[model samples]
Target chain A: MTINPYHDKRLQWVAYAIFFALLALVPILLDDAFLLNQLSTFGVYGILALSLSLCWGFGGILNLGQGIAFGLGAYGMAMTMQMQSQDIDTNPIPPFMLNNALESLPMIWEPFWNTGTGIFLAVAIPTLYCLIFGALMFQARVSGPFFAIMTLAMLSAFYTVFIDLQPYTNGVNGISPPMPLEVGSLVVDPYSTTSYWIVYAVLLLSTVVAKLLTQSKFGLIVRAQNNDPERVRFLGYNVAVYETLIYAISGCMAALAGMCFTFLTQYVSPSQFDVGFSISIVIWAAIGGRGSLLWAIMGAFIVQGAQSYLGDEFLNTWILILGFFFILVVRFLPGGLAGLVELILGKLPNMSKQQKSPGEKPVDKASLKEA
Target chain B: MAGVLEIQNLQKNFDAVKVINDFSMDVIELTLCCLVGPNGAGKTTTMDLITGRQKPTSGSVTFRGHVITGENEQMIARRGLGRKFQIPAVFRELTVRQNLEVAYSHEVNALKNIFSFSSRQCDARIDEVAEQVGLQERLAVIAGTLSHGETQWLEIGMVLMQDPALLLLDEPVAGMTEQEIEKTADILNTMKKTKTLIVVEHDMGFVREIADIVTVMHMGSLLAQGTIQEIETNQQVRDVYLGTEDH
Candidate 1:
């Protein structure tokens, strides 16, 4: 039971259940395996968008290099998956490593052979990186556009280093041609229903976790921090800690999404960590409605679906079309698709109702008018 | 009696200018002290120094037998000192009750606040504060949608939710109707019974109603300190501040 009438938790859950159920039905109803597999990729993209939404909308952090975390996750998974394919007992070093004149299998590549370790590193590496990086930025009291630019600059540096480590990383070519992921004895093929289910389950799980977090008492402080960080600090909150933690959480989600992407596509490349890919993730969140997680998910699906459909037809003008679309959304609908929902909900009976604002004055309307 | 709060030889300078110099004041437990000054008398700056918003160039602020110097606002606030701004500083998007809940959840460290909190105690505290500030009916109303007076009361309620031992208020009744000011005076008067209060107010009439002690500042230093009647008659206070005012 909720104390406030404004957010009826039961009603929200009902709506949430219905949406996820419909999403679950997509693979069952669609006969085309190819389209269903593509849908799974879109779901993974949606997770990336949701991560950005939480950071930008809820935490008021603008990370221009969100792909850094996503790329880390992708590379972690790719490295692990690549190791899974080789007969490591006899031929531990991959062909690329040998080609680069490596004397021995590097100690860093050893643990990634285990899927659990790979996934663990995939999530943990980005989270720890962000936690340390966030603490530095926030403790120094850097925020807004400056924070955004710093993150972007960091991604450029990270990308340069990642490219330079050619022997371990495979450089520009990236990690590819992995065997199907094995869990115990069960082989999870890229196109398999098990893989789709894995992505589906995680997307839903993370969304709920995100929802619970943003609705918690901690969330209350975070929102308060966003409104007036100084006031919240004076109210006795360590806002730097709050901001840093949220940033770290967002990074974890992005990396998780990246890991899922690698599982579905069986490939992870430097392109995933590029500036363009990071910007695309932001555009999806903004287009979908950064304020609402569900809308952000839909934003990814719609944009990726449109891109696939239009990329073949309008290969030259696709970027310009997307730019115009972004401009229109920003100009006409500042809140994106989620704002439209709020506007509509406002008109519906009992939907947007809260206590009459300006408050219940003891003075009557006549007295107020006279005053 | 040992002062509940003490400020001694406090100084704050901006480049070449001394905003507050040798500012000294002691607030006894459970007493209301109003700081009155002319526009450039450094009233606001003194509040900043006490609250640790700005570290003093040289001085000490002792609260509850502890010298809190060069500490940040969050740490100082956690030491049981609450502050209210001249403008209503309540979170605009949150409901009145949520704002109170946030203020009541005073642990401030995110890790402790993450998964769980004392909601049962917090909710009770919220209701109590909402009632105290006469916002019981508007608990669910968004703070941004409040009228100017209501917003001020909400901020007061938020500060009260934490139940700090000392409260620092800056212009608690700025831009209010006559009745709102009276209500605010009543709230401050009530608070002084259980908590020490440091109020910076330009409204002389309001100060006269609730101030247990009046400290007048002139040119970044204390000109006079005494009861309202004493401050009114003091030749120095009249010359520096009272004489120039609408009083």
Candidate 2:
């Protein structure tokens, strides 16, 4: 029988179906709550990795402050849940405020205690931050190393501010919400396996939404802008607007991931938003392939799963390995593992039609010389 | 027709070096003008000043009677002026069809872009433009994979999709083959029927074929402006071209 290389959509679907089937069986087979929780953590990381991919991969934005946005969302939910447990009006100050502090809670922290306000702020704060950052950087035509430095500086600034604001943020110790969330008569025991499933559902929905957006016309513009901003601008596009929009969207998605993270850990701390987390998320995207959304999720899973199995003794060493992996992929495998898979598949004897010709060369040598 | 582009004493300086000094030009209706000069003769700077890519040190540029002296690049572009860079700027990862679609200005929102639909008008127009540029066969091909000549054509096709009133092209056929150069001349010739075009190039052969009038520049100042034959025999032009040879 002749193999139809053009009809590989079936193979693609089957691969995804098998992967999900394996994931669904994990909770049933392992039965170990700790393992299940680790898997849930991986799901949160996957969401974050996917979000970063949208900005960095598609938009060509080297955002190093993604963890700050994620922390904002996680802390936003944690604060609201804390207020709910204390029987206080979900206002700025809980009724138990007198016990912890002599005066009122800060005004900015007030909106975060209400559930609706908390959810809104979870997505809003990061989006606003990214919008402002993007507006300044893109308008100034900052790119390459300058763009990377600006993002790193922003990340460092957010980290320092969170660490210094001990009174409101609870400083390095971080804030943890109580178990079994009680909102009015409703109690949500997040420790239950059902809560884990809910988090998974959110992850799947957000992934689908992100996938749709990446394939859309706006996504096309973002990708184009990445390759050539000047051309997009010449086409009468406000390149800054597109960059800002992508930043905001990625920020909101990161924030949503943080919300899911808070439900899993019931904690929000400065350490969670540190530069280390930011680097780890980037590593996830890089390992997956810079521009491929599916690869980003896979990268998160592979990295987090390996870390969980290997324990903390191997965790520090993992960073070194990841750094080497990044260098290797950037140098040898420009497309990462997914790109490698495609290459290997193309080389298969039966997949001749799907293969790209080997002799193809770059077209604009003179343009590069002029630049 | 009313003056679509009017420049008054446009001057630009880089540190102590004056790149464009007291440069002035007026473009009326659908006319093709070529700006020719030696390397570092401020041809690119002149185009930059008109397109709002580089702000002039001192000068005024009016487009469509609107004083666009200090407008931003995007605003200037939106005001019915299109620019094609000397470098063939294109989205390498996208297909030719997708590149044109993104360049088409039907929807401009960033948030709603993902759910937006391309109109049938957009598809038909893309096809028409691609066909005009002889790139219809390569519509599905990735733009980065195109030949140098093809990429230049694609960039021009992208600009054509915008359907601007004024077009600024810098060395549109810099590295193209002779045949490709002929095709580019034909494309520009066809476009001049409906659009005012200002092209900056060093290839006198190509310029002479398509230019309605040629402007010559030396040391950042306009040396002469007239038909190609008029400027070629001008004493000062001959002196400048010959004087540099003795050095």
Candidate 3:
């Protein structure tokens, strides 16, 4: 058996176990209901960031429309919850329908009322969208800048469609939960801390699954495809199929995260799935390092945690700071925090000796070229 | 058992320039045919046409007595035709073993590939090919980190894993140390026992070492076809190759 040092399955499982344990203890350590709620939201964002990493990092696809998939999932769950709350016999519609002069709920929104159907739609819709989009783009061999532009176009189009479909989607005002969910005499409030922790637990499990997928044989293909897709194709593998699979998987993951987000916020609005959210997910993946799933989740938690703790004071400057950070990290720290950690660990012995040297000569350009 | 490759009136044109004008060749089973030509001779394009990478203007590429002219690359590959690009085209991010495993993945069956059982036989074959290519020691090393010579070997190893009846290698040893080139020649010689090998290479010394027959191409047409010494002495072949005395 050939021993591969780069990917160790046992080490990965151990790491995931540690992560799960730590997340399970968050409610215990924090103890504050509001902080726990924020943590739950952070968990949702972490899942989104991890999904973005899987697509962009491993698959070499720049998905600028991830928020669109998330919105689909969130709205799917929200619409179903809203319809169930209304308790209308034939066509269960929200009160907003009467105000808009609509007599009954649309036929399309009926499937979402059932929990199984809602969850299925939450995964299926985004996956189907990505499958169609990926097939078209990959078959056309649209990559790099063209791929980015195409995804951005899709994001804007989805945003417009969501904002325009007022009768079904409620437009920009979005949809909110009418009441707490009652599952066979069990009442579960979305706003409750216990409910938030449940969402957090789901996030942790999803992240673990994502991490495992990355380390599998399928994951290796994805990583290799990103580095040199032509080579993968020449190896008798279908490069387009690999890309499409990852794209759909990433879309499903984003949708799952959005489902959690609906529970945390109890609302699904157009603004939540706008370009801002899409770009923010990219930022999280970038700060975490594109290669590692753990780093991406950490990047999400740190960035969101800082934003939440800093409050409204830093809200105005957050975008600017994030933009600058993106530029700085891409320029100086190519691997983000993960790369920095590796560098620091590498120089542990020389750190004390080189403490006095403030600035050294720049790294050799030729060596960088070789890498 | 039959004609491994039969190209009948293969025609290809790039806009106005007519490259590969009515080119044809017949390669029998288990024969090592070396394709030698100067730059722009369309040797690579010939392999591309055979492997279904590029559609010919007018031609028929029959592999194992079956027409595969317009079949997709993956489909052609699954039909026991493996190709190596001019550049070493191995998955750089993956280890040598992982690269071979992916190359040896199950055939493209729409439904079977979705829910296929892992093939232990394929794993054994990968190990066998790794040993053949002298990459057994470097099986765990990332292909991107390998030396240029090792990368070429890794590419050849990937092709070997496909278990193809006919192998098309393009510039298999373009940039290699003398020892590495010699090793590649030895591997090719060993490979010719079971597979029909068509090598497009410029290294005449290496070509002379393993090729059973030499086919000299000039400006996208066959200049000469014979044994190594026969082509080496042919006046027309000399004129096309600039009469390089190294061979």
Candidate 4:
């Protein structure tokens, strides 16, 4: 079989080169720390959208509660940072633990004291959660718009749980480390160049991971099932297993994004757990053209950059503008921005000349059958 | 040796309507069996039951001696049972060769399917299946872009890629040109020498071209089982299925 056109290696590498080159240009152009921090935030959002695209766009699973995994990862990072801030001896307790008047650290909080374990939990917890949750839902054959609602419902439940668990979660106010991250001899100042580079590295790593997955044999089945799952099943594929594995993988990506987001923002709040955040993640992917990884990442940057720029002056109007813009995009560019580019490339004379033969006869079956 | 397929006292009911009632049939190995019947005769339903798309109301479907009545479709399919739908259900977005590669059942493990790339042997086998179905030229073309006849061949090629022991094809050549029909008949005729196939078709000419054993069904039950010529002369099959023009 010829290589899938979607996985065109040369085009993918060029896109990657352009993306990283643009990212490299960012720090050089913008020397201001605040602006650099904002760019880093957008980078985190790009990872989030990329993760959503993997599941919803490529895998054909609309997980409206992707924020649940994101929120969990963020919480994991925030909790670890907070545990690091606490004294180990006379008052060996996290400040949030003191908020609920606890003298001793909880057993769960002990694991986050080590930054390595904390990072592991950040990615691992959400991955495990998705494995269990996705297995149950997919095995039960829950999918489509119904699957979306189920995920949203689950997000609401997790939100409630996070809010009610005041001792562990710090209630609705959430958890933020009182001090800059200090691991023995090294102190990671949240606003330092080190923090920016760390977040940047993580974002790049997340993108690479996502790219490898979508290009793998597993990714082939994902795209196939996205078209027709019944056909895949009849071909002897375990549809549930395929969906579950992809869902969990997607969750891991989101968790990585969340960990970086928490590191950049230095806080995890209840707002991150909202269903709207998850939906917004989906919209970001849609804006970029969910079908392509690079486009989805760029989509997040464009949409979030616009939101941040206009958000101050227009406040409430900013959201309405985004909604209107998304509607316009859906109407005008069904394949998103990347699809529009593909459409333009398809129309060019040279491309058109080469495509005319195969394009004219074979794809005309619908009209032919009508006659 | 026992028959490759043995369906004993098989019954299927959808809600209150009994579609297949007390149907029993056995086809020996490497046979091209054509099942002919009018509408609502449970011809497709029997295929579905054998392929585990539907649960039998009663009785067992034995493939190679193992009872596989209520197993899931994927499980049955992995056990070398392949089926082509009445409507050509192919991965429309994928290329024709990719369709065969996806259905190629050598590496059926879910984990292996994800991490592993298609082997050279798999590619060679796919090419062979494509050539067999006269789709070698259209291998790189997207399946959805293929003509109706081509899509039908692609689906058949997909089933053939698995090298299934028992293949259930529903209307193998319903909407094909005369040339395409002849090619399809030639393909099926060659395939039956090595594989067992039960084809359900309304096209009598295509059936006569390929069928060695013809079984006639009427009202969810078998009416007659014999050589195509024998069934053509059977009064009961002629009255219930074929009109009197066939002498």
In DockQ terms, which candidate is top? 4
Candidate 4, residues A1-371, lDDT tens digits: the string is 44443445444655576567668777777778888888888888988888888898889899999998999999998888887766677667876768798878888888887988987998899999999999999888888998999999999999999999888888898988776666667776666676667767877887777777776667777888888888788878888999999999889988888887887788888888887898889889888888777778888999999888878889988888889878977899866877766675467564442222211221222333654
**What DockQ, on C-alphas, does every prediction get?**
0.54, 0.55, 0.40, 0.56
Instruction: For each candidate in the order shown, give its overall lDDT on alpha carbons.
Output: 0.84, 0.78, 0.78, 0.83
- Please identify model 2 stretches exceeding 4 Å from their true place: A1-32, A89-100, A182-186, A312-316, A353-371, B242-247
Native contacts kept, each candidate: 0.67, 0.77, 0.29, 0.68
Q: List where candidate 3 sits over 4 angstroms from the true fold.
A: A1-5, A184-186, A348-371, B107-123, B242-247
Compose the digit string of candidate 2's lDDT tens values, residues A20-96: 56667766777777667778888889889989988998888887878878988887778777766554444445434
Q: How does candidate 1 score on lDDT?
A: 0.84
Report the C-alpha lDDT of model 1 over A1-371, residue by residue, as the tens digit.
12543355554555567678888998788877678779889989989888888888788898999999999988888887888877767878888888889978788888888888887998999999999999999999999999999999988887887788989888888888457677678777778777788889888987887777778777778888888899988888888999998899889999988888887888877888788889899889888888777777888988999999987799979988998989998898877777765565456465334222111111112233664
Top-TM-score candidate index: 1
**Full-model lDDT, candidate 3:** 0.78
> What DockQ does predicted model 1 obtain?
0.54
Off by over 4 Å in 1: A1-6, A348-371
- Which CAPRI category fits model 1? medium
Local lDDT at A237 for model 1: 87
Query: Better model by DockQ, 2 or 4?
Result: 4
When summed lDDT is taken over every stretch of 10 residues in candidate 1 chain A, the lowest stretch is: A355-364
Steric clash count of candidate 1: 0
